[model samples]
Target: MTDNWSEVDLVLKTMVSTCLANEKYFGDLDSVVGDGDFGYSLARGFEKLQAQYDELDRTDIGTFLKKVGMLVTSRIGGTSGPIWGTGFLRAGMTAGATTELDGATVVKMLRSAVEGIQARGQAELGDKTLLDALVPMTDAIEEALAAGATSTEVVGRAAVAARSAADATAQLVAKRGRAAYTGERSRGSVDAGATAVAVIIEQIAEVWKTRESR
Candidate 1:
């Protein structure tokens, strides 16, 4: 089944709640390697986005997603602003005017987002950045979709993969972002960015599951 704008709205709400609740954890993760502002930045940004959520155009997914990108970029601070902004912006463009998304469509959108993040961040798979989580998540989504899984199933599988990737970051020496400055010391601590990515992906999956249950 195709997913609607209402589902997108629910996903955003879930993300806002998830980010706010885990803000301190994200900050703690970042404090070990970076500026310790990752959680606060996401909380502040998503809260602002939530405030204007009702005003967003719900007719077209592309327009809605583009608005989200602009809001995050303008309201958030640090490297996360541009990286997430570019990712959402590219995903929106890839989605075009679609009002509903299917398994294949979601995969395409995620792939575009991953590519955009890579272009903006210049990060690779093992960089211990959000890409470390997002890339594998997208790969899993694509695989699930190819196997004829529903959109919900695709996202569920992807979220699990993303979480695993985020956890795996603990063993990697960061090669990008502020964490890179720690050299080998970055190992043993999860990348805050990757954790954020996994958390958001899990939130999306939760929203979908909740919707399906209802």
Candidate 2:
């Protein structure tokens, strides 16, 4: 992939792609428990973000990310939009407007992103939202970085953590969002947001590993 992104941009790209891909996933799954419009809303929001990416050259990473956040929250009707949007913005902010991100910075950025999501959504780790995956994944990144793992290694471990966390969320009863309406019934289902988070982070870490090998 010739589209190289710095720390913030790497995350931004992930958001854009995950939202787009989730349009289908959300449509298919949301039909089961919630409105099918989740896909349409996510598609429109990310499509608008496609235009914002062109402005990247004209702005700093943090500014660009915040703009994306604002646009997503403003356009998309669902909780997913605001949650992911704010997560990206907070991550960029944590990186301190830098152009490059090493292991430590990326770890901090991930943690900040998770905090942002929690602050905005008021969802805890067991809420069966994206936080279920993101918090644990970022926690792994932080611990890996503290142990002197390379950026690639930290991200790889984080991706694995994210996936496992996402899977684990299936056994949890939802305490937030529409899924919460299902009460105990939500326990066997995977959260759309958490699955999307794991997918994107896995892709990112995979790319990082491939880049390192090359």
Q: Who wins the TM-score comparison?
A: 1
User: How many backbone clashes are present in model 2?
Assistant: 0
**TM-score of every model?**
0.94, 0.86
Q: Candidate 1, residues 1-214: lDDT per residue as tens digits?
A: 3566776767678888899899899999999989899899988888898899889776699988998999989978898889988887988898889898876777788789988888899988898899899889989988887888876798799899999999999999999888899899999999898889898889889888977788
Off by over 4 Å in 1: none
> How does model 1 fare in lDDT?
0.87
Q: Each candidate: what lDDT?
A: 0.87, 0.75
Query: Model 1 misses residue 17 by how many Å?
Result: 1.2
> Can you write out model 2's per-residue Cα lDDT over 114-197, one digit (the tens) per residue?
888888999898988888988888788888878888777888888999999998987989888887888888878787677777
